[model samples]
Target: MTSEEFGAAPTRGRRLRTVVVFHLADVTGPAKSLRPRLEAIARRGGGLDVLAPAEGSLAGAYGDLGTVCALPYASLTVPRTPREAARAVRSFARDVGLFRRELHRRRPNVVVVVTTALPAALIAARLEHLPTVVYVGETFPSRATDGTVRWLGGRVIARLCEALADRLVCCSETVARQFVRLGSTVTIYPGISRIYAEGDRAGFRARYGLEAASPVIAVVGNLTAGRGQDTAVRALALIRERLPGAQLVIAGLPHPRPIDEAFAASVHDLASELGVERSVVFTGFVERVADVYAAADVVVNPARFDEPFGRVALEALTAGRPVVASAVGAIPEVLRDGRDVLLVPRDDPVALAEAVSRLVEDPALRDRLVAEGSRRVESEFGEEAGIEAFEGVIADVLEQRSNGPRSRSSSPG
Candidate 1:
């Protein structure tokens, strides 16, 4: 897609109306990143309507930008039992009918499915012959432990997406590479704002009982297994051996899944085992995440998995705090090793400790990383950049649909 295509004025006929279908109604990473894009649609005199599973924080936030509709949908999950598989088929068919009815009633010009998890929405849009855009944000895991059943399920989902959707907007090139067989794929980096850069440093430190002069290390994602909060805790113990006044602040809540909850408990247990529990603070969920960056001197992202995009690392750089992250996935795509962020090996506590300690002790290195990181975020990952890229994709899809029908082999049905 060219700049002229994306920057062109809206077609001078009927008004453009878009309906976005999402898998979850919670305040998740995808929902947060998509807010600016939705706003851009409204700014271009396009009507917006959102469909979600239920009512939650995301629904409320999107209500201001568009008409929020509560439509239930289920994700395609690998079921173990025979009964579970039967029920999954039933639920999927029911939800597809629901979505098809809703789309027919709304009569949108184009349909946007926020995540690849919602295959039903793509199928429904195809049945209606409406142009569709699906956002591919996650990479399917092909590890041995994932089990053959789950791996096959992932392949099925990818094939369904490739067949049904008109275009796939991937979050990063790493994610796009996974869908090489797909006909149309675009990599649009999610944007971040400078909201995190403005906060009360002294007030946040006082509220969290952190010493004014102590070195504070923060990890800002949800408490999940691959998030590597346990690694951060261990790194804190190693850092405190030299700078005894160091503190580690963990600032997000876990998902309701049993595995995630267990991982959260294990992180606390590991901190206690290292005898550094006293130096660690667990603030479950902060309403204003800017406060966490304000109280921290350095941020760490020791993710063990192939993170599709490092939003926390971007936010830290935008907040003007130096970052030490694992050199995995698309992280190295946006952040450099010495210039923008200090890249360390994944799941290695000793290496993570050394990087965090080096940044804390060397003020010149921290300043240089922060300066370079801020410049990169402004130039490439600003809010306007994402909006323009997404708008371009939408325009291209609409134009193609107007010209003729897209060629595809099969549908989910």
Candidate 2:
């Protein structure tokens, strides 16, 4: 059948098979972000396949996936050096060849490119004449951390990726704003898995060697300078004065950059310097994140940078824990100050401590925040809205493609 003949849209009951591609094996980035949606598509009796750097390397992170039909090839996440970037560009042709073979095999209804693997995936989509949707999770004008080299070709590469895609799905309004002038863009806030609500508090505390009655505060995300775990550790010094039994839990490993063991150690040194060494618990890379949230008296997202969207905060709120978050980027949009969460300026340990202390000391305030936070998560940050919105976008893009690709500028997003 001609592409125009297949322009008809699928009804509510029809199935839509999809193939999602990623660049890196990062445990919590685009690959992990889209896994739940892929499962949803499968439950509807629709087929799902994932193409990425390597399959078994990171598949274990998603322990819940009984079977993962992931495709692995030569790919890198955000190239740290110009040589690496140039090499990745050189490898694009090979990636396209591999992608073409996959297209012939699956004959997917649509191709979805998760964060990081942009131009390469886009090239593959166009080569196969398949509709493409790229989800933007990280910032653009992308730069490598700890390196001064400018990815001089980044802008040109980004423009090409934008022009080729049928649609761009951004993780937050802030991310959407960064790319609106490029081409079609839409804000689709990422969703957190509901499994967090099931973690047992007692088991989590026991695993971390935390006392059952201790007031534990959780600061999740990679242990990096930008993530601001130092701020949380420093706050522990101040928190211990008011609530002597208060403890701090740092629940993740280093980021994708050069493993910053020095920085991670520096955070611990700061904790010890503040005389709170005994109170700080570093639970490096726990698989059961829900457990960490459930065991916490309060949760904090103290990232110093403008976080694209703080999914950790959503997970905490979903688990019914009061949140103390940085009021920057799209976070203020996800959570409200005073009502749903206590929002403080980024990098301010004093304010972070005070906010966390308020939740720790005031039982009524904690209860109110927990109630409002869960309500907000259920209304917006839960899996249903995001999954439905993403699925609809993919379906619409495919329909437009099948319709013979008019400049459908009216609904550019």
Against the true structure, what is each candidate's TM-score?
A: 0.91, 0.84
lDDT of 2 by residue, 1-413 (tens): 24443355755445766777766655665555776766667667666666656554355644343334565565434576789778776676676667777765666667778764457667766766778888887765435532333343445545666788889888888877765354488888777777889888999888779999889999988898878999999888888888999999999887545656778989989988899989999999888888999899999999877787888888898899999999977788778898889999988989999999988889999999889888888887667787888777877786677557522112111
Pairs clashing in candidate 2? Answer: none
Could you give candidate 1's per-residue lDDT for residues 77-141 as a string of tens digits? 88899999999999999988888888777777789998878898888888877789998777776
Query: Global CA lDDT of candidate 2, please?
Result: 0.76
Give candidate 1 regions above 4 Å deviation: 1-14, 405-413
Residue pairs in candidate 1 whose N, alpha carbon or C atoms collide under 3 angstroms: none
lDDT of each: 0.84, 0.76
Please name the candidate that would achieve the greatest TM-score relative to the true structure: 1
For candidate 2, what's the RMSD? 5.1
Best by lDDT: 1
Instruction: Give RMSD to native, each candidate.
Output: 4.4, 5.1
